[model samples]
Target: MIRTVVLDIGETLTRDDRYWASWGDWLGIPRHTLSALVGAVVVHGRDNADAIRLLRPDIDISAEYAAREAAGLGERLDETDLYEDVRPALAALRAAGVRVVIAGNQSARMGELLRALALPADLVVTSGEWGVAKPARAFFEHVLAVSECAAEATLYVGDHPVNDIHPARAAGLRTAHLRRGPWGHWWADDPAVRVAADWSINSLAELPDIVKAQE
Candidate 1:
């Protein structure tokens, strides 16, 4: 039985559609260009703050992104209330005796983001706070150790293949790739990794049944 559901924050819990789109729209650049710019920044060994600074020299772009993310802007763009399904899903999991924790990389704005979105989770673990990027065994093992959840009974739901699925699987945790965008097929087929999600639904509304079935 699944005793805990560990979630990834940025792409899985909160959609980046508006955040990315806003950045692209503000710079008058296509989305792909924005993606390329971000890639270049990462390639150049720039951290998140540095990447944002290089993107828009005129404004404190990193702070702006942080504020907007704290306020949950993506749902607004989709004409939906932010955290519409998040709170309810979390409550359901809690009701079903499943521990809910957020394992992600974020800056100091994490509390604000969860408050703005009204997401309830038992713990929040981040690479920035932990001083390590994920896809490393330490990331998964650390969270499991801290949360006191068995690696085999803890499931991680995320959007990224390598950073999320691969590492979590290696840690003996089940994985659910929340597929719902252009990057969905990035690892739809890979032998080194398994894509058989315990559940493969898009919206968070489908999570309750998914978790219950694991028991």
Candidate 2:
């Protein structure tokens, strides 16, 4: 049985609109411009943060982030930022006795923001807090360590193939590629993603049935 469902944050559980928009505002650029740059960056297999660097090659993202926070323009998340299916799917999984964990590449404050929302989860953590991010073997090792279960029993889900499916699978965890976000859709049909992922799902709502099938 799939005992644990560990999920990524951005574009997996939540819509990234507010996030990119916030960055756009902070950078004093049109939201659409930043959005497009982010798309281009991701499409080229570059980091999403490269979008900002594309605009200002010398910018210190960490410093700018601190400046934003100092100016009261930091990250913020709420119910509206979440996809409609998040609560229902997570609740269903938890009700079915599946452990729900939210772990993703986000800031330390993001962990706080997610906790403030009180989502139905056993743990809500971020790379910023752990000092580790996805796509790294070490990150998956941490995931396995915290799962309280074997990798075979833990299912790691996320929208990004490189950061989620590939690395998690490498770590021996069952991987579910969520085809909900840009990265998901972009790589969904690729043979690499299909091969790396044990399952490719468009929504979290589909997860419960997949878990039940193992019964």
Candidate 3:
């Protein structure tokens, strides 16, 4: 039976548009400018940090940018009830005797996000906290160690197939893929990793059933 559920934040439990929209709202910068800059950096594979510095040369770019990002996250997420479906799903899992957890690539802002969304996770694990990235064995290993959960009794859920599902599966944990976001179409075609999940659900609303089925 699955006793632990580890969730990834971005795309799985949160939306990317919220971040961009919040950034525009908090920074007083034009949304289109931010979009163009993001496209240049991400789509064109340009140096993102350098591009941000050059684009807004007049501002103390790093501090100002981080503050805006944080403020935007706080505004859209922390202050607002962002993860409405998430809380109930987690509560249901908790009620069913499943341990709910957050395992992702968050920095120091994780606490703020959790408090803002009022997420009902029993544990919080992030790359910022572990000083490593997901899909790396150490990340999952560290989480398992801290939680004291056996690999077989734990399940890891995320939007990315490799980062969230595949590695966890390899590590002997159950896996779920939330398949409706930017990374959705990227790896869906890879035959080796195509159907790796123990279960797949499109929304957080379906997660409780998946967890209960295992239990």
Candidate 4:
């Protein structure tokens, strides 16, 4: 039985358009230029941060992130940033007596912003708060701890295949690949994603039914 549902943030919950656009402005790069580079990096299986590194080869990512924050141009989260189906899907899961957890590779500040929005979930956390990121064993260990359920009984949903699908499946949690964002669309048809995720969906609205069916 799927007793818990854990979701990733970017693209799965919120679109990264504002985040990237802000970064582009901070870096003094045109929006289209940075976006194309980001897509190129994703296609090559590189980290999204690498897109910045490609444009500014000597930039220190963490330092630049801090600089952005110090300048008051850091991570911005508001209601409109989230996908339309997120709230409804999370609510349905909770109504069905399922534990909902939101955990993703986001900064601690972003975590605070997310919590401020008071999303419909039992727990909300991020890799930055845990001091570890996804595709790492420690990250999944944190997830399992927060889930309070056997890995097999938890369903992890995210857009990225490598970070969400492969690792979550390997860690023994059931996974759903959400085809809603750049990474999602890029890798959705990959055989690896198909093999890794227990379910592949295009919308969060489908999640409650998926959970119910498993039960």
**Of the candidates shown, which would achieve the greatest TM-score relative to the real structure?**
4
> What clash pairs does model 4 have?
none
List where candidate 3 sits over 4 angstroms from the true fold.
Answer: 22-76, 79-83, 185-190
The C-alpha lDDT values of all candidates are 0.67, 0.91, 0.69, 0.94
Single out the weakest 10-residue window by summed lDDT for candidate 1.
73-82
Residue-level lDDT tens digits of model 3 in 120-139: 77876668778887778988
**Candidate 2 residue spans exceeding 4 A from truth:** none
- In model 3, the number of clashes is 1
Error of 1 at 129 (Å): 1.4
Each candidate's root-mean-square deviation in Å? 5.6, 0.8, 4.4, 0.7
lDDT of 2 by residue, 1-215 (tens): 89999999999998999989998888789999999998898789889989999998999999999998999988899999999999999999999999999999998999999999999999999999999888888888888888889999999999998899889999999999999878988889999999999999989999899989976
Model 1: lDDT of residue 132: 67
**Candidate 1 C-alpha lDDT tens digits along 55-166:** 6677766566666667654224232424467778888988888888887765545534454544577776667677666778988887787656788788888766667777
Candidate 4 off by > 4 Å = none
Query: Which window of 10 residues has the lowest lDDT sum in candidate 4?
Result: 66-75
TM-scores for all predictions: 0.69, 0.98, 0.73, 0.99
Clashing pairs in 1: none
Comparing 1 and 4 on TM-score, the stronger one: 4
Backbone-clash count (model 1): 0
